[model samples]
Target: MKKVMLIDCCVRGVHSRTLMLAHRWLAEQERDSQVEHLRLYQLNLAPLSAQEVEQRKDTALGEQFAQADEIVVAAPYWDLSFPSILKVYLEHICIAGTTFHYVEDQAVGLCRAKRLVYVSTAGGYVGQRHLGEEYVQTLCQTLFGIPDFVGIRCEGLDLPGNDPEQLVAMVRFG
Candidate 1:
């Protein structure tokens, strides 16, 4: 069976609108693939030590990330990016020779994923301020070798007179 890596970075727990929308998207789109659901909040993730970096090629996280057929990342916008924990998780999987390798002194991706879908929800409007999404999209091409990058976002969920449920309901997977 093909694998779909679901990296859940919704840190707000049961109250996260981002998490709510992510679940809806997953139920509708990823019923066929085997899902490896990773909740970032529950995982004891941390910044890599020098020793761990050297051993990353043999780590399970790196290998699984490389082998995933597709990737879905669910995170809310924070500090113009994402939670620090997601950064830590990314560092763990970004192993040389696992996710990427140096070629001619330049980094080249080695991951097997063909597409990466980034799902996010914002409180205020996020017109051109998708720093987090842009960062991931760049990584998909340059570090993960993913050809297709999709960004599905529901913004202004907390704005006055706006309904979060309606916004999430209106979000399209297309």
Candidate 2:
């Protein structure tokens, strides 16, 4: 069975619209696939201190990324970006000799995942200013060697006179 890693970065947890959309997307995946769900909020994740960076501890999260055949991330847009917790998670997983390694002058990804799907919801219309998705795409494709990248986003949820549920329901994933 294909192993999929679901990284939940939604700060609102069960109340997040992005989480609802992500659940729907995950439900549509192949029935035989195995999903390893990692809830960021539940994890005791701390940013790497200067000393920890030098020590280079092997993390379970990095191992999970290396083992997965595919990845999915769910996060709500916050301050034009995803939550800081997501960034901390990335920092933990993007370890050298785990997710990626240096090849001469270039960095090569060692992760087994071929694709990553990012699901997000925004309070207002971010439009072309969606930096969170762009950052993740670049990281997955260029650094993590996930060639295929997809994003499902629902914008304008907090906009005046907009129904949040209807906006969230518009998200479609294959």
Candidate 3:
């Protein structure tokens, strides 16, 4: 079975609409793969300081990212971007010579994952304004060497008259 890493960046945990959708997706994916869930908030990861950057310590987080056969990130949209915790977790894993390396002055990814699925929920209709999705996709392709990038976004959840359950169901089926 393929090793799938599920990165949970949902700030609200069980109360988060994004997480509900993500769980639905994972349930389907689990039928065909081995899923490992990493909850960022529970980890309490801190942003890399200037001192930590210089030291370049070995981290289990980076190793986990590198070893996964596929990655599924569930992050809620916030302030036109994903949460700050997600950014910090990304920093922890995007280590040189681990997740990526330079060859002939060009960066090459060392990650085992061939695909990445980004799941998110937005309060308003974002449409083409998926900045957070784009950022993660770029990192997956350029830095992590995950050639296949997929994004599942459920928008307008917090808006009046918008049915969040129906939106999530659509993604679950389609």
Candidate 4:
């Protein structure tokens, strides 16, 4: 059985558009695989402090995240980027000799997960602007080295005539 790590960073709980889509995505995956959902908003995850970073050489957070075979991160775009909570979670996971390591001048990933799925919703169009899906994609590929990364984005959510349920259908089945 494959272990999937589901990181839900929706602060709005059930009202979150990204989480709605993510729930459906996870349901589809659950039909075919084993999943362990970890809601970042619900977790008591602490931000990496100066002391934590300095003594992270002995931390176990990275090893915990590395145990997953597939990872699904659901985050909303806030102020053209992900929420601060997700940022803190990333810092905790991106530990040396864990999720990533330094090989000479380059940083490499040590996570066993071969693929990463990023799900997000933005208030406005972020397709070409600095506030869109590209930033998340770049983080997954460049920073995290998750080569197999895919994104499902629904922009302009603040606009009218945008049926979230329909969008969920498209994201889940399309």
Candidate 5:
């Protein structure tokens, strides 16, 4: 059986739009794949200071992050980007020689997971011209070597009187 790591960074718990979308996507996946939900809002995660970054050059944290078979990150868009907590979590997960390794002028991903999906929602019109998906896709591809990357965004949610069914449809099709 395979493992799926669901990283949920929403503080709204079940009420979060991103979480709702993630659960919807999970329903489309195989049943036997074990799901491990890691909620960032509940974790005692901290940004890696300069000293920690130095020490992370040799640590077990890298090995821990490399163990996931599949990765799904969910977070609501904040200030034109992901939440700060998600960024902190990413720093911890993306370790040198663990999630990625640097070679001669290039970097390679070391994780066993072949695919990764980023689920997000925006309160307002971020515009289709924005690289919200591309930003996340590129990061995963470049740092984790996840050749298969997908980004799903549900935007314009802050508008007055949005339809619930329509929101679900957008997320499902996303």
Candidate 6:
């Protein structure tokens, strides 16, 4: 069975439509696998300080990320990107010589996950404004060695003249 790590960054908890979509999608993924749900809201993850960066201490967080066969991130789209807490988690895991390393002026990924799925929701359209999603996708491939990246975004949740519930329900993760 594949080991799945579900990183939930839904700041609004159960009220987050993005998280609702993520859970729905995960439920559909042939459930003969181990799934670990990590709620970022409940974690007291500290930002990477200058001392931490200089120290480059190995972390168990990096090991967890590297060992997962599938990594799913459910982070709500805010300010043209995902929440800041998710970034903090990334700061802790994306470590040098741990999650990745440099070799002869090139970077090599150490993570073992084969796929990365990103889920988000926004009140406005997030087509061209998906800067954060793009960054994460790129990082997954270059920094983490994840080849497949799927991004599912539900927009217009709070927009006028749009049925938020219908939009969410209409989306069938493929």
How does model 2 fare in lDDT?
0.88
Compute each candidate's TM-score over C-alphas.
0.91, 0.95, 0.94, 0.85, 0.88, 0.94
Expressed as tens digits, the lDDT of each residue in 25-76 for candidate 1 is: 7788746788888898888887998988666755788888899998889999
C-alpha RMSD for every candidate: 1.7, 1.2, 1.4, 2.3, 2.1, 1.3
RMSD of 3: 1.4
lDDT of 2 by residue, 110-151 (tens): 999899999898898887768999999999877888899988
Q: Worst lDDT window (10 residues) for model 2?
A: 165-174
Candidate 6 residue runs with Cα over 4 Å from true position: none
Residue-level lDDT of model 6, residues 16-95, one tens digit each, is 88888988888889869899998988988889889998986888888898889899999888889888998899999988
Output the worst ten-in-a-row residue range by lDDT, candidate 4: 127-136
Sort order, TM-score high to low: 2, 6, 3, 1, 5, 4
Task: Supply the TM-score for candidate 5.
Answer: 0.88
TM-score of 1: 0.91
lDDT of each: 0.85, 0.88, 0.88, 0.76, 0.79, 0.87
Could you say which candidate leads in lDDT? 2
Stretches of candidate 2 off by over 4 Å are none
lDDT of 4 by residue, 28-146 (tens): 76566777778787768878778887787634556767778888888888888788888788778777777777889788877788888888888777756644356656666655677
lDDT of 5 at 79: 78
The best-first sequence of candidates by lDDT reads: 2, 3, 6, 1, 5, 4
Instruction: Give the lowest summed-lDDT range of ten residues in model 3.
Output: 165-174
